[model samples]
Structure formats: structure tokens, C-alpha cells
Target: MKRTVLLLVLLMAAGTASAQVPSPSQPPTPPPMPTPRGEVLYSCPGGIDFASTFSNDGELATLRMPGQPDIELSRAPSGSGFAYSDSYYELRGRGREATLTAAGRSMRCHAAGRPGEPPRTYAGGTLTVTLFPDGTFRLRDRREGAAEPVLDVGQWAQEVEGGVRMVLRGIDNSRRAFRELSVDKLVADDGTELRRTEKTDPIDGKFRLAGMYRDAQDGGLFTACLVGRTYGVAPGGAEPELEKAWVEATPSREASLYVEIIGGFDNNNSITVDRFLTLKRDGACPALVFRGSALRDTEWRLVELDGTRPTFTEWRRRPLMRLDDAGRFTASTGCNTLAGDFVLDPDGLRFVPGPMTLMACPPTEAEIEKSFVEALTAVRTAQISGTTLDLIDATGKRRMRLEARGR
Candidate 1:
């Protein structure tokens, strides 16, 4: 009886101790961060926002807008900044600013960064301004689509009441002071507004194309390294300099030298040389051989026939070819199909024609098909440059050109 009574007292004491101890409380949730105003990667004047992400190679950008489905766009040739577009919508961005156009309506946007940050670069109307952390500044004035700057100078700068002041020292040692509206801007004393811009890579702009320059009877030929296009150097201010450099580098009648130049496109098949850079005797395009083995299993579209571009009325009427792992191939001859067996050994290639369908074709298409088959039969080696394929004959002449489809 005494033992039972002691156990009952111990249970009652345990219950009292448990009741006196409080339960552990949960941690308080953190408050959500407030989104800053005017921080729109894709925004409108009324405060609408949108988002976008780019592909790894920067070839595509997908956009997401409020109350709308996602849209994907392919990168297109642009004169400045980055441009992506489709049949319906177009988007262009430079530095931290962007503009989107849809259905003839345009909207401006700002990336997610506060303006007026120090140590920044800004550009507008061919003027580029850069601020340094050591209280120094530089300005460059160059024309659009040109690399060589017309006016370049290092100057002194300091933070002022509203923004920053830049002092320029002329050739006569006379000092001139100017004020910028903001750190993110590059403005002149005359109130020319400059927008923020990022520094570009050496090969990123329209100028600064490095390639191989070969002298030809009709002016010259320039095969760009990264661009992978052979262009006829149009007569311009830099033509005389280019010829001089070529003659100096190689006096031989048949000369092929590497060169760099600042220029823009004259047409689809030629480039106007604005400035000539340098010519190297030992330089070659390294981008050609890097992806040579990538030919197999890829859909190839015929781009050139016997060193000339082939024209087709419709895209579906163009020639197409594909090589398989089993050493066999199939191709489209614009109107019929052709099957064959192929042998690929390192950089060499041989096509053994198997069978082909004889279908009635238009006169122009028939002539193109005849040349195309002849060129393929003459191919003894292949050279690849990114998405381009050049089929060369035993004599080292490029007879046929193909490109990876859908590129």
C-alpha cells in the first residue's frame, strides 16, 4: 500500500512539471522583399513587367509577359545591340535597356539595376564615355559601324552636386569643363543625352572582322574566320591600303594572307572596307577544322553550287542531304530523291551514287541539279566552319557548299 502511494505521488509530480514547462515556439517568417520601382527587364510606361531568358549560345530568347503565353524568338542580324524577333514580335536590347515592339506598338524597358551607379560606361550617337574609380575618365567619338575612334582622350572627373563634372584639356593646354546629368549617362554641355551601354567584345561589333584575304582578278576575296562567309572586297577608302598590305606581305602573283579590317556589308555577297587593320603571313582560320567531324547525322542544306549560290523559288524546293552512321546517304535533288553510299576518312569523303529518281523538273532547276550532281561527284575533301560545309575537289577548289539546316 505504501509503495503504490509513492508511485501515484511520482506520477502526479511528473504531470505538474510537464504542465509548468512551455512548448517550443516556431520561428517567425521573414517579410517578403519589396520590388524596386522602375526595375523592369521588360516594362511599359504604365508599370507592366515581363521576363525573358536567353539560350546558351544566345541564339534564342524566350519572353514571358503577364496574362499571356510564353513566346520564343530567334536572334536576327542587328546593326547594334542584340535583336530577337519572329513574324509577330520584335525585341532589341543594349546594355541595361531594352525595347519591345508588337503589333506596331513599342514599349521601353529597364533591366533590374539602379541607375547612376559609378564606374560605368555610357554611349549615344557614336560617343562612348567611361568613368574610372581613380577619378579619371575617358571619351571616344566614333562613327556607327566603325572601330577607329575619331576623338579619344583621357580626362579628369569628379562627383558634383547633381552628377559628375568632366574637365577636358585641349591640345593648347586650355581646360574645358562639362557636366553629366547622371552617373549612368554620358551627356555633353549642350544637353545631348547618352544612354548606358556595356563594353563589347573585340569580335562582337560589325567592325573588326579577322579573316584570310586572297587576291583575285576582280578586286579581292575575304573569307572571315568567325563569320564563315567569303566576301568580295568592295572598292572603298581602305581598298588601296588593303592592296598595299597584301603586296607587302606576299609579292607572289597567287597570294593568300590573313587580314583584319573594319568594314560593313555592301551587299549580301560583298563588304565595303572602311579601314584596313593588319596582314599576317602565318595566320590561318582556326575555326575551320574544330568541328570537321560534326558532318555526319546532321541535316545539310545545299547553299552553293560550283562557287555560286543556288536559287530556288520555294524553300522546300531546295536541295537537302544527310549522312548516316551506316555509310549510306539520302538527298533531295529539288524534284527527286537520290540515295548513295559514302566513305568518310578523316577529312576525305567519297560519294558513290547508288540510284536516283528521274522526275520532270523546270528548266532552271534541271540546270541547277546537273551542276549539283557534278559538284558532289567531284568532291574529294570537306572543310567545316561552324555551320558551313565546303566540299573541295582534289585540286583544292571549293565546288560545293552546304550548311547545317535550321541554323
Candidate 2:
């Protein structure tokens, strides 16, 4: 009975102990955990950005930020350091060492180099950061000496598309102020932007002033004018000039009755035979006077030849009649010479003559000689109307119609 009572008491005590202790098979409920503070949402080839509500320890803190400029940090002899975010910025330096923690990592950096230490510099340094449950992060720089911020933190942003627009204002060395431009657009493999097309402005304009027309048969000077000005005359002559003299044909004249002067200075000076001569069948040829620098005071007679042939034979040995592809005519007047090109048209013929050589001849002969040459070189075209030959010069300056010399 004593042993039973003892065993029961022990059992009751064990049961009470067992009731006090939790069952080993059952797991205890855990307390609620705090949310992580900081995170690295995005990064690019040049930069990265981390956001956290961390306390700023007395030491300088550096962080990589997107779209931000690079940062730099340096140490001074006063056991102090300077940090900059962009080009040349100076930051406050404290003697305390700095630590940074972000993205589940941490780094520590000292203010200055140690004794007997080789000089060391860092372009980019490893970064470590720790995030507390309270949305706070501890950032550390794991370099021997102070370092610059990975980039300018001022321009950091989470979602930057179409990018931030930056306006740079400054004066040039010449004191000329201008605005700088920055454009952001997608580019193709050829380096051309997808948005830009075709040039906006024009390239050039038209050609002007082709040439002047001169009648080959008559000494008519004609020029196509675009500027409302006459050409082929004495430069200072009448502003608005008329077309050069022209020629027409009359009945009973041969179509090749024009004269043209050749072999002169630019054909400026030449002689011409008037086409108005009437052809007479008499054995004696009609006489015409050619007065110019090349001509002497003499009369030349035209001899009627048999078989419709025209020839010149006298003191001066030369051809009396010359025929060109256009039926315009040229002949030696026994002096300065005569030549012309002519144009034959339905209405009439245009004649252009060359200028006469300024050689001084007898006054009476001078006028005739110059006039004859001027009449010839200007001939533009020739035609036959009835028995008459009409000659027109290139410029339509001069015109002549000749009747049949021999009836």
C-alpha cells in the first residue's frame, strides 16, 4: 500500500510537470517581422540608384543615382576629407570614418591613408548597405580613403523616360551667349534618328541670258532680252531698241542674191552687197561700188554668165557670188568685204550684217562700204519669193530683197 501511494504521487507530479512544459512536437508561434527598408529598383551601364530613409552619420555618404553626374571624394592633411557630386564640387568633411549599407551589403571607408601607405585612388568602389526593419539603411564605402559619390544624387529618379531636359546657359569666349541643346531620341543602327526626315529648305535657282541672235544675210542685230534691255548696239544707245534691219523678197529675183563679208575681226567689220540690184540680160554686167577700208575707190561690174552661173572677174580676182547652206550670200565688194546670214520666214526674211572695219576711206565711200559689210554679216536666213531673194540676218537687223539682174 505504501509503494502504490508513492508511485501515484510521482505520477501526479510528472503529469503536473508535463502540463507546465509545452509539447516537443508542436512549434511555437513566431512574432511578426518588420518590412525591409531599402532596395535597388533599377540600374544601368553608367549608374544605379538606391532609396532608403537612412540616418546621416557625421561621415560623408555616397550613393549611385540614375541620371546623376559622377561624384568624387578626396582627403586633406587636416585629417579631413572632401566629397563632390559633380565636376568640381566640394563637400563637407568630418574626421569620422564612413560606413554605407544598401541592397543587403555594407562597406566601410576611412578618412585618410595610413602611414607608409601607397597612394590609392578609386574610380568606382564597392558599396555595402544594410537596411533596418524601420525603412532605414546604413551606407558604407569600402575604400582605404575618402571617395566620391558614384554619381550626382541630385538628379536621381525612379522612372526616367524621355529623360530630363537640361538647359545649359553660358557665354562663349567671344562674349556671345547661346543656349546649348540636348535631344533624346531612339537611334537606328545607321546612327540616324527615327523621328527626323527630309530637309526643310530648298537648294538653288535657274540659269539666265542665253545669247544674242544676229541675221546672217543682213546686218541686223537682235538679241533675246530678259532684263528689258536691247543688245548688239552701241552699249550706251537707246535702252529699248528695235529688232535689226530685215530683208524681204520681190518677184523676178534669184534667191541667192545676198552678200556676206567674211574673215574679219569677229566679223565686226565686213562688206555686203545690196540685194536690190536688178538683173539685166545685156552682155554688160551692172556696176556696183564697194567702199570700205578693204576696198579702193572703184566700180565693179557684174557680168551675166551663161547657164545661170554667177561669177566675178575684174581688176580684183575673186568670186562674185558665194552660196551657203541657207541660200544666204557673200561676195567681195573690191574693198573691206561683205558677208551675211539670213533667215527666211513666211512673212519675210531677216538680215544681219557685221560691223564695218573703222578704216578711213573717202567719206562717200566710207558710208557705203561700212553699210554694205554691216548688211551682209547680219544675214540670218534667206528665201526666194517670186523672182526676188530675201535675206535676213541672225538679229533681224538688216534685210534686203533683190530683183532678177537679167530678165
Best by TM-score: 1
TM-score (all chains, Cα) for each model: 0.32, 0.17
lDDT of 2 at 165: 16
User: What would the per-residue lDDT of candidate 1 be over residues 333-376, giving only the tens digit for each residue?
Assistant: 78666777777653467888666766677787778888878888
C-alpha lDDT of residue 231 in model 1: 56
Q: Tens digits of per-residue lDDT for model 2 on 1-407?
A: 32233234233323201122333332222122111122111111111112111123423323322112122233223322332222222222222122222222222221111112121211112332222221111222345664642211001111111121111111110111111111112232233332211331111111122212233223333221111111232222221121121223312221112211111111221112222112212212111111010000111122321112233333343213333334344444434344444443333334454322233344444444444455555555544322233444555432444322210
The lDDT of model 2 is 0.25
Question: Root-mean-square deviation of each candidate, in angstroms?
Answer: 32.6, 57.7
**Model-by-model lDDT, in order?**
0.57, 0.25
Relative to the true structure, candidate 1 reaches a TM of 0.32
lDDT score, candidate 1, position 16: 7
